[model samples]
Target: MTTITLVQGDITRQSADAIVNAANSSLLGGGGVDGAIHRRGGPAILEDCRRLRASHYGKGLPTGRAVATTAGNLDARWVIHTVGPRFTREEDRSELLASCYRESLRVADELGARTVAFPAVSAGIYGWPMDDAARIAVETVRATETSVEEVRFVLFDEPAYEAFARQVG
Candidate 1:
């Protein structure tokens, strides 16, 4: 069984085997966690992303899908980039949101990552409610079967941490 952990800190600083980035489809970089990872992980990350763009992801990564790249300067061996769905009341897109966690874990398992640090996918700029995002993330990780030994949700704020804590509890 995988142990679920929560930390109220920057995901970029967490030293895990893999760090999950809540990236936009562009994969080049954007605000929030994506930009932070790109900035801290240095040019090598962008270089890998560029290569991915040139080859497999020419139209940008699709929502609910995930891809891996070098961790670069961060304290991890690989960075798994997962695009999250934008929340909207008109439609129930919770499955796509849950896929972010599931797919990241899939990529982690593929990379032989025992420990992975993840941010709150889509809860930031993408506008997914914190409680719902937390619930989906925790529930999905709990349900998924992977080789990862530890899955850490590295939240960026107290509210986000508390939200995940509630679900984790």
Candidate 2:
């Protein structure tokens, strides 16, 4: 069975096989995880994202939607960016959020990524509670059907790490 690991550190600092960015639909750059990833990866990511966002809109993110730019300043080779839900409206937040995780894993599998890392999507500025967000993340990873051998939750705080650990460990 595939397993998840909880690491207490910065998601932007991780060097997993594929690192996921909780992006806005625009995919250019926004606050929270998207901003952090773009900043660490440098302007190249934002440039590519700007191109993609120009024509990309709506749901499901085109399934195999991903772009491989230079690591900029980060450790990973490819930054697999995916647009997750905003949790702004209280409708179908769970399904939309779960779809983000599932779609990210799908992208990773296509990239032949054996290991992938993710942040707590929708938990930062979207206002989802930490534990609730962690539950969705853990469950989505478990439910996903992919070739990935390792999944890491690169957390920003001790509380988040512990919550993910309890589910995965």
Candidate 3:
């Protein structure tokens, strides 16, 4: 059976089987969680991502798809980076954001990852509502067909933490 866990913490510093990094198309590393992951993961991750980024062009985003990398400083063994859609319109954002969870699970299954950690997609710079994002996350996770044993939502703040906790509970 699969388990969905709501944890108040940092995705960039998780100690699970795999952690999801919300990245841009560049995937080279930008600000926010992306910068933190890159800094901690060191240069090897960037080098691997550069090549992965080239071959995995349009594959970077749209929510559902994910790319894999070695976990540098993180406690996990692998990092599965996913790009979530940012929209002023929910037209595609909803489906895409939900897919982020689904696809991440699929990738984890492929990598034999039994546990996964994620940051709240699009909630920060993407401006997605915290409650809505948490709902989508829990729902999509509930729908996954992979053998992911544990799913952890790592929140960076108290508000986000409480929001997810309320939804999960």
Best by TM-score: 1
- For 93-145, candidate 3 gives per-residue lDDT tens digits of 79888988888898999999999998997788878888998889888888778
* Candidate 3 local distance difference test against the native: 0.83
lDDT of 3 at 101: 83
- TM-score between candidate 2 and the true structure: 0.86
Q: Tens digit of lDDT per residue, candidate 2, span 50-160?
A: 666565542424422444444467788677776655565546578777877887788787788888888887778777778878989899899889899999888888888
Where does candidate 1 stray beyond 4 Å?
A: none
Clashes of each: 0, 0, 0
Q: Write the per-residue lDDT of candidate 1 for residues 41-63, one digit (tens) a residue.
A: 99999999999999999999999
Model 2 ranges with Cα > 4 A deviation: 55-70, 88-90
What ranking emerges by TM-score with the best candidate at the front?
A: 1, 3, 2
TM-score of each: 0.99, 0.86, 0.92
Pairwise TM-score winner, candidates 2 and 3: 3
Better of 1 and 2 by TM-score: 1
In candidate 2, list every pair of residues with a backbone clash. Answer: none
lDDT of 1 at 108: 94
Clashing pairs in 3: none
